[model samples]
Target: MFQDKGALISLPAADIAKVRVPGSIFPAQELLALELREDLKAAVRLIKDICEDHGVDSLVVARPEMFTNGPTTAWLHNRIGGIEDHICISDGRTVRVVPGMTNHAFFMRLGVEKNFERFVKLQKRCPELIRGLASQINSAFTFPADASIPTVILQPAEGLMNLDPAFLPFCLVRHSVQATFDQIALSGKIDLTENFSRCSRLIYVPLSEIALQSEGFCRYIAREIAAAFFDPTVGVILALPTAETAESDMKAGIETLVEALRGIPGGIPSVASHRIVLASQECPESFLFQGSRRVELVLHNSLDAWLHPPEYYGRFDHIVVAASRATDTRELYVEYIDHLLGRRPEFYWLEHLALHPNDTGLIAAW
Candidate 1:
């Protein structure tokens, strides 16, 4: 069916009969063969149409790795008459089969100075030019880099007070119309100006009222918080349910968080052994405590040091604090845990400043 009218064609009769047998069990194989044949026909038609439109009499096939002896190249030469006369093949060290054109002429046309000898000498100095060109062409289209910034979650003042001192420096307070950084600073109980100078350590992120109302936005924030647990630069993340957050939304957020955490090297088992704390105001229905052994679930109104006692909190490697009103008690819980664990000296920022001062400037700009 692919051949022109009155054109002579060769066929392997046995092979054709085997594949074209009626009610064959190998339906998938037959379908694939048909699809491949149709695709080749389409490709040939497109190429012929392009050539006809441009009024081209010959085709120049330039390939960095094509071999004259290769069956595919030989078949292509046979299928397209006079294609062999215009073929150009390069094997890193040398270019061959230029036909009417000389190596020196080709090199000159390609912007190489002087002659082919100069091109050869340049290739010797930069071997990557010959090898990487094909790979560069192959990878011209790719997925864009992940440019989205981490979502910032703003906790209540009481919640912020309870945050682990180790994580305090990395915390970013969101300054919405509902609550501003200046208003929080005036409280006096929490020294927002001294500790968080120039909005450096504890920065204030201004979020629009629309963003705060978005459930999808809230879920994205939850995923970011969950992702932070695995990030070396990020310390403990304190997340509390806001008034707008529904139980379903909270469950969905937790599910996303759990999925992200489970992607760690040793999976959930390793995460359970880590010094991680998950504190929430209300228990989401999606949180599964089934297989987790080292995870301790503590239900308390306030994570006050005196009420819980040191030994009880000290026993577990990972703790999940669930309170009746988690938003109200989150800070106290984090504060209590921070006090119990004792703040370890963090020099990540100092190290970053020393190593990548420009990157730090970029971060500050962001």
Candidate 2:
């Protein structure tokens, strides 16, 4: 809507009909209202028509591989003054779009060399920009990193311990404050409420508390996590480590504990014959764990580790967390930023960090 390339582009009616806009600072109702506004509708129609003429027939915008720079997408976004989110669907296709600019670019356009006085002057003149940006900040939680795939995130702060046994296979909320452990009692062999009491009190527990937690508790939680992953029907396991501990410490802890899980008598190894694949930032490694020679290891410290397709890495039917509570407070903020960038959460929720990669001076999370 913001651009006028004069090239007609018709979108697949089906794809346009399926486009979902999540509730951000604005609620779903509010976003719908805005979408229905005369101006926006007109803009969208024009944009759609332009896209259709250029053979952009579907809402599916062609994209480069995840993490690989898309020259065309970037060029279009820069000219159009907007950001576009591709919603991927099954069959390895992207058929949905969330498009908007959060005014981040405006401030960024001022350049690092700009003075604080200049920012103050600019802010006074751009009242609408300020208001719009504020709205964007408040609407963060509505949309999550595209749920097009059956991907689930085990946040570091709240591992599989926070989830009920029944919902282990289903998707979960981003924040644990929402209805996580509300219905704790279940008629299962293990009393989930009884075992992980300390872990479930808050979204995140300190490292000291984690250390004090019983091995039985860890093992029990681990067992349940393993059970969720190794369902006999499941093909491969994607183990994503979300712990906020030190890089070395969290990596070592996860690798060791997972190995232990495999060795646990009657645990995952006994239940399923799926391979466990881990993404690391370093080269791939291999080792025998509990007599199962079905683990594929690779280095992928980037978030892309979790975002990439299962088949690209190998056989994988489900993704589970090797998640632990983040130990570092800074990691919490970094985690939020990652969520903001990947999922486009409301901005104000993370505005405190100034979106500065190096807000801590010494510890920049770029």
lDDT of 1 by residue, 60-145 (tens): 23231343456755554454443322212121123333222211101101111122234445454654333322111000111112
* Candidate 1 residue runs with Cα over 4 Å from true position: 1-75, 81-222, 225-260, 263-366
How does residue 181 of candidate 2 score in lDDT? 22
Number of colliding residue pairs in each model: 5, 25
Which consecutive 10 residues in model 2 have the weakest lDDT in total?
104-113
lDDT of every predicted structure (CA atoms): 0.27, 0.26
In model 2, which runs have C-alpha deviations exceeding 4 angstroms? 1-131, 134-238, 242-278, 281-366
TM for candidate 1 is 0.17
In model 2, state the lDDT of residue 107. 14
